[model samples]
Target: MLCGVHNHDLAPNLSGHLLAGRLRGEEKQRVIDMTKSLAKHRNILTDLKEKNKESVTLI
Candidate 1:
């Protein structure tokens, strides 16, 4: 299963599984950080696309 910022709704479920597993604290933090980064990047890409569409409409 894929886990990332895009699927935040699944975070609680995933966290439960992770907590039940042997993943270390540091590793878990890394995963959380990575997810946040992915989400930020997705937002940036979405904003850029919207701006591009607006510019295209103006052209």
Candidate 2:
């Protein structure tokens, strides 16, 4: 299950590169937007996890 989620998360990045030369203007822009959004969310998740770890350590 975790592996599946990891693969799903990577799919867009892989697709963007695989289809890079083939993608037209709007499609390429869409991929870039999706990647940016994913990165933003991933950063938020990482921050939350770090905070959780710190709290656990203090407990």
TM-score top scorer: 2
TM-score of each: 0.29, 0.30
- The reply for model 2, stretches above 4 Å from the true place, is 1-21, 39-59
* Residue range 5-29, candidate 2, lDDT tens digits: 6544444333225443254465446
lDDT of 1 by residue, 16-51 (tens): 354444434654464467567775655544544464
TM-score of 2: 0.30
Q: In model 2, which range of ten residues has the least summed lDDT?
A: 50-59
lDDT of each: 0.44, 0.45
What lDDT is reached at residue 53 by model 2?
A: 43
Clashes of each: 0, 0
